[model samples]
Structure formats: C-alpha cells, structure tokens
Target: MDEKNHIITSPVMGTFYRSSAPGKAALVEEGQAITPSDIVCMIESMKIFTELRCEHPGIVKRFLVENEDPVMKNQALIEIEIH
Candidate 1:
C-alpha cells in the first residue's frame, strides 16, 4: 500500500491552539496516529473556541502553523500521511 500526503486546513480564521489550554499537553503531536473523529486542534475567534477535527485517518507529519498563530480559512495547518 502506498501512503499519500493529506493537508489539513483550518476551517475558520482564528488563532490556532495546540492544547486545550496553556500548560496542558498538546491535543495531538507530530507522528501521532489520528482518526476521522479525532480533535486535532482548536481555533479561537472572538473569544469562542472551536475544535478542529480530523477528516482523514493518518499519521501527523507536521504542523504548518505554530501554536497561537493566526490562521485564515482554508489555510493548511497540518500535514498528514494517509494510512
């Protein structure tokens, strides 16, 4: 089987968060296995936080945006190697 690269994009324009809160373990990390229902990250807009879920099953290759970085809608946030 061949593995394909999949880009996970931000669904909304907001600040990206790797963890639920500061000083907390990251929700997901590089090289972590992820499922379609997995919460990959969080985005905060106007003080409202939204959980960003994975749409594909794969291994997290890397994060395109750093934590607390502002991202635009449809901006690539993570690179995943599809299972």
Candidate 2:
C-alpha cells in the first residue's frame, strides 16, 4: 500500500454513499481538500441521515467503499491524508 492509504473513518454505524443523491458526483474526491467541518460523506441508518465530517484538515486520498455499500459501526469510509 502507498501513503494514499490514509483513511476517513466512519463515526457511526450505517451505510456509505458516494453522493448525496444518485447519479451525482461524490462529496469528496482524490486530492480534495478536507476540513474539520466539511461534510465528506453521508451514512444513513435507521431511516436517519448522518453526515460524516472530517475531524482535521487534510486531503482525501481514497474512499473505502462503493456507493450504497453496507458498512459496519466505526468502519473506514475513506482514506485521507492527515498531513
């Protein structure tokens, strides 16, 4: 694995989606700037939508799952460059 293997870990248990709506682009892409208050992705569970934001400023190196993939609690949703 390369340094791009950095991660955007999920803060809650649910499903991961690349975009807010179908056929739309992802919230964050490779080399995209990530901020502590940025909404990088959304995790929906129990009919509620939980937007997952970054805890620090960095770059989004990778995303761990495909759109609409079922994820577990505390799973890695993306790989981010912390530095």
Which stretches in model 1 have alpha-carbon errors above 4 Å?
A: 1-3
What lDDT tens digits, residue by residue, belong to model 1 across residues 1-83? 13598887887899999999999999999999999988889999889999987777989999999999999999999888988
Cα-based TM-score, every candidate: 0.89, 0.81
Candidate 2 differs from the real structure by a C-alpha RMSD in angstroms, to one decimal, of: 2.6
**Clashes (N, CA, C under 3 Å) per candidate:** 0, 4
What is candidate 2's local distance difference test score?
A: 0.80
* Count of clashing pairs, candidate 1: 0
Model 2 residue 28 lDDT score: 82
lDDT of 2 by residue, 1-83 (tens): 56544566666678888788778888888789878888888888887888887777888877779889899887877887776
Model 2 pairs whose backbones collide: 6-79, 7-79, 7-80, 8-78
lDDT of every model, 2 decimals? 0.90, 0.80
